[model samples]
Target chain A: MEEQEKPTKVVDARGSFCPGPLMELIKAYKSAKTNDVISLYSTDTGTKKDAAAWINKSGNQLIGVFDREGYYEIVMKKTK
Target chain B: MVTNILILGDGAAGTIMANKLRFLTHREDAEITVIGNSKYHYFKPDGIHIPLGIKNYRDSVKNPKFLFNYGINYVRDSVTRIDVDNRNVSTQSGKNYTYDYLVIATGDRLVPEEIENFDREAHHFYTLEGSLELKEKLSGFNGGKIVIGPSSIPYQCPPAPYEFAFQLDRYLRRRGIRDKTELHYIFPLNRVFTMENVSNYVQKLFDEKDIIYHTLFNLESIDAQKKTVSSLEGEDQKYDFLILVPPHKGQQVITESGLAGDQGYIAVDRHHLNYGDYDNVFVVGDATDLPISKAGATAHFQSEYLSGRIASEISGFVAEELYDGSVACTTVTGDEKAFTLYFSYTRPPRALFQSKADYLLKWTSADTYFSGMLRGVM
Candidate 1:
């Protein structure tokens, strides 16, 4: 039988500001270990773009991006 | 019918007054001259967010040239002397200009080195560069012991230090380092805020976040080389990163000019917004030693009220009215909700109006409107 990896942490940042949501995501990613996954949800209009930018520059893996009811749910996996 | 209106400082209040003069008054006789050293008006409300590495310096600045469309004459020079008896203000450039109605808008000054580490290791985010420097340092931060504390009272935006800590906690957690950073908040106040309800709310948030709090302790000094802050209680705190909110005072020019109160703030009547000594001079914003938090919203409310008084006095339109001392702020709760509170009293040292919102739409909209108006792009 193959061992399964435990899922990492998730950050919900829905209804935050440009930097507010981004800052929450960053804090979550920092406490997470390499290969750990962190989820972020945001209702701010700027979060989707800012999170994508931060992930690209910082080498974090994009697990998924979803939009629900004009809100964003971005899942990123920590990659050191 | 030409009346000379002399405005000092060229900050938020002064700029607003100048704009109001241009917009509301269409009389050809009004000549407005604003005496300020800086060619740009700084949007200081954004200063708090600067150190968190969120707001840029450029975002705080707008061209002074935009005042031209508002019919304001801008004089870019430091005020050297304000002669109330002569009704004249002298500038650093050796020019003396007289005023029919003098509006003193010289804002608050940061009392540098009020605590040990203020200018040394701990950085303040009240100015554009100060905020930028703080931002640069904060962005590269991985995780460690972080301490945010206010040295004393009467500082601009009393809730800023509190706000910074809350936001930082959320910021660090998002980056997966929340557990790595041990955050502490130290305030000398007996309560989080003077207002009972607001203080309770703030205290609740601090408790919920597990941010350590040291209340009623005075900040003595900072030993930068030691990277420690010694409290007046003889306790030393070690912090990898320190954000210090220094005590604020009135500008030296106001004190030197003998126009300020014993506390170095311009003394004004709570009702008419007039100088207690000289009726011709009007003081507004942080320059006045009012028992209220020095924030942009207060200045806006003050300006809106003061403009009417100025019109009544100069245009002989209406009787003098009193300032309600109403003010409020939006407490941004970590990319989720921005809490709004309003407070003011009917008497002196009064907290008159308080309102709270869970969004920043009104704040941001106001910022955009003011910025556009200042740049003549509105």
Candidate 2:
């Protein structure tokens, strides 16, 4: 198995619907850097909770989540 | 190295068999090859949800590498010819492969143009491209009269047409356009579902959802230029959106190879799923002209039994009895609630009486089951 890395980036999940953003997030986290910042921009209303739950379960750090222009921007850090 | 097993089709049957074959065999010489055209293995049951805006195409599609994770060799190629007499198969890339045992699971093809002007206006979501196109069409329009219907019988996913209607009702309502949109379901079947109990449950759902149902309905043609669908009843209905489920037939390669019957489906025993004349060849999923609905659960259950029979044939041991043709399915009724059903030839399918949370957990956990099943095979 390869060593895991933290994600230091923000993903624009805006305009993408459910499972779309999450799928992209999963794919993104595959090559992330440890303790790096990963942000998700989603226009779907459900992402705020979905991303939060995902962040918690994956043992990642939630930096901040905010609403802007009818979209939610969630930031996380790879903290393993 | 008793035999070289070749399985065609990357969908449910072939994928499951390849993994199961690896699990059931102890010999290192046994080789299994899976050939198909698609690189993305879709949970086809989710295809219907695309047009309803319930799920996107990406969520339903998994890379073919997912199969590789099961330790199955994946060949992304199209089969052009099968010479059963020569015990060889040819691909479009001019590669010829031979097998001691063959499982044909290429499934079915949809002919949308069978209905006049169908390709011009009516959209089908059975294929990946069709589903993506339908998603675009549905996402843009918030209000319109929408109609969904089947082009012919014996199509894949019997409950999909009704589910499409029900989900669309929910989607439109969520968009605040339900008042502007009139939802109607038209099918050639006498009832919404083949199983009496399922039909009763769905009929009650339709009543509650305010969706119209037309039974024994046949579509004659669509004047795409005029945006109207004409039925056998001689009534021409106008629609802002027309979702079409096209007529399905077996793959042309199987038909050309003379392996398929008049309807292009291979003839197989209901219990064993083996080719009637050729014992070494087996058919499962949509490729077999089975009497049951072409749902994913049928393929899963059939795979479990077929794999055992194939193993016994290889080991010269007596395998268990064949499949009883059992199927289980869940119908999404919007609002995060769904109805699960189990059906068999002996009895009608009724609600499984399970809550949606339990169902979703199991449904999402299917990958775990598949992984474990494949590990046993690998």
Candidate 3:
């Protein structure tokens, strides 16, 4: 396992469905400063792809998507 | 010994079933074909956001050809008829396709002409064109009595009209004209929702929003010239703007084929989803005459169960899963808050109170709907 950097903000969106995790990520991204890392946890099966697509579209940096127990954590860095 | 499976309508139910069936019988010699009227499939739920200016019409549409994986034939043509006895379907383009198994997922049709003067007077939000037209109309309006409700029962998405009212209120407040606008919701039923608990909860929300609720107001006719809607019991209500949920019927092909029930919907076993006397025929989605809300969630649940049943029939395995008509819907109130209603045939619907998290879930479900459900991945 690689050593993961601590996130400046963490949005716990587990147990929420599709847009929930993605929306929370967007909200966190909006409030985050440049180079600030944010992590989102979600149980929705579609969030992994949605978050990745959103990150690419918004010109943010995707650090990694880690699959946790019964959920997934997506980390991103605010580049703009 | 090759089996030809034909599915009608490339909407949520048809699209999901096609992908699921293809996923299940990949190694087999079965042929899967989907007949749809349009090349693009629109997410019907997103239509609700159009009138409120939350989304554009183009964003809600997806090309069905790109959504389906390999080995599934997609035909973009209007269906003329279904010959159940011969197990064949004819398209308007003078082509006939024979099928060993048929799945009718054509969904429902909105008929505004059923109500007097509705076509000429009242506006609706059920169609893409209608939603856009309403969006344009709402942008110019300032204030007055805005009456919104279903013209009949069994309309698609039971909570939509209420959501429209809530969103409209939010829109009016944003424009600083809420005080001048009088909002009212008319329903044919006595309650705000189908379930008792959900109805009570929604009614309370309506009270909080200051939206007047009128129950048992069955629409009899719309007087376009007078700009009033009259109920069956001789009550007339004037309106500056009317958003009507037009009467819905099964597709014309289903009704003309004589496969529809008395209500113009296909009758199938609620659990097995098989049409009577036709083991190879299955029905799902709003087209079925099931005692449940005609919603995309219900169709999604039905497709999941029906795909397994169809796969079992083809692979010689017994399908143990039964459909319970389970449906889940998110009701968006204004201010980025929403409630979720989950229910089934055997269970009463329960509504989760207003929460920003639920609103986020509803917003994110669009991704799941387009990618997971449409692609047969979830």
Candidate 4:
């Protein structure tokens, strides 16, 4: 990842359950400025699939989904 | 020879078992039939959210018929009797079903009438209708004492009353009536929760929230006209609004069918979910006297083990897995935060503190889990 692609804010939602991580990401996105990248780290299995789907459906730009050791991270940019 | 399996009830337990059975058995090897009183499956846990206006009643309902895609027969009928001696069960419509094996998953029955004046005065959030009514009542409330009490123990979802109290506290604060409304939680047990760690954690939260807690206050009766409730120890308390978790018993059909124990619950071998002497009959969910919290999570865990057992038996092999009575529950404290507990019969429940992530996990996974259970994926 390039320095400019780095998230403005990183939400650590590890040890939380599914929608918990996604909800945090949405909250961060709501408070974020346009073009500001936000990354959510979650251990919940459903976060990767559900959050990606939600971001795509809401017309946000999903940078990438990464599977790290023991957690998954979803990066998104607040386009609107 | 084709094995005939008849399952009672179409709630969480019955539906999951039906879908799993369909997946495990060959079409020509077994015939699976499920009989339930209602056409729609209501996620009972979500009823608590209804009164708080977090979700609507319609969102919690799903057609049970939609779950029967794998050639399993779904019958919408009330069970009247189960002649275990003859291995036949009768329905209210005079339909008789004889089976080589039977699964009893009929859930608990709410009996508010057992308490005097409760039927007339106390409001509850257990049923779909009651939740909707409570939602309307809560919206118009301005101030006064709000009492949430459980009429008896062994109720479904052990954490519900406490969760309701927490959510109610949050609700009143949101409505800008927090100072005017006094929140009280009355429990039958000596502590807030049966599990020690959970009780201690919740007690701290309760104290921080300034919610009054009354312990060992088993409900005796309610005076609707006076807006008061009396405890078994002759203690009386007044309330402007009452949210009662009414007394629950095994479905009448289980007792009427002469398959229930003295406490009106099916007596099953705790580990195997089988009744002694009735080799072919098994019980699960709220219907069994399993000495565990009668919640959907318990049923889900039971299904995980029981499904394999039934499948092995049907395949002419001895079933091996033993259920550990594991239970997992997520308690929504308020709109933004929630907590979860996971435990088993032999272990104390481990508590996960309140977080927005936990809340979202519960909110998002509920629907997917429901659909997955219906499709026999989980």
DockQ of each: 0.01, 0.01, 0.01, 0.01
For model 4, residues B1-378, the per-residue Cα lDDT tens digits are: 999999998888898888888889998999999999775777887776888888867878878788665779999999998888889899989989999989999988898888888877888888888888889988988999988978876788888888888888888888899999999899755567656578788888899999998865667778877889886435688999999998888988777777775347887888889876777899988898776888777888888888888889889898577898788878877657888888886666764689998888767655865778556787
CA displacement after TM-score superposition, residue B150 of candidate 3 (Å): 0.4
Give the lDDT of residue A35 in candidate 2: 68
Candidate 2: docking tier: incorrect
B17-118 in candidate 3: lDDT tens per residue? 999889888546688999997656777777668888987678777877788868899999988999988988999999999998999999998887777788
TM-scores of the models, in the given order?
Answer: 0.76, 0.76, 0.80, 0.80
**Chain A structural similarity (TM-score) per candidate?**
0.83, 0.83, 0.94, 0.91
| Interface RMSD after interface superposition, each candidate | 16.0, 21.5, 18.9, 19.5
Q: How many collisions between residues are there in candidate 2?
A: 11
Q: Weakest 10 consecutive residues, lDDT, candidate 4 chain B? A: B187-196
> Alpha-carbon interface RMSD of model 1?
16.0
Model 4 has a DockQ score of: 0.01
Give chain B TM-scores in order: 0.90, 0.91, 0.96, 0.96
Candidate ranking (lDDT, best to worst): 3, 4, 2, 1
C-alpha lDDT values of all predictions? 0.72, 0.73, 0.82, 0.81
Model 3: pairs clashing at backbone N, Cα or C within 3 Å? A18-B364, A19-B364, A19-B365
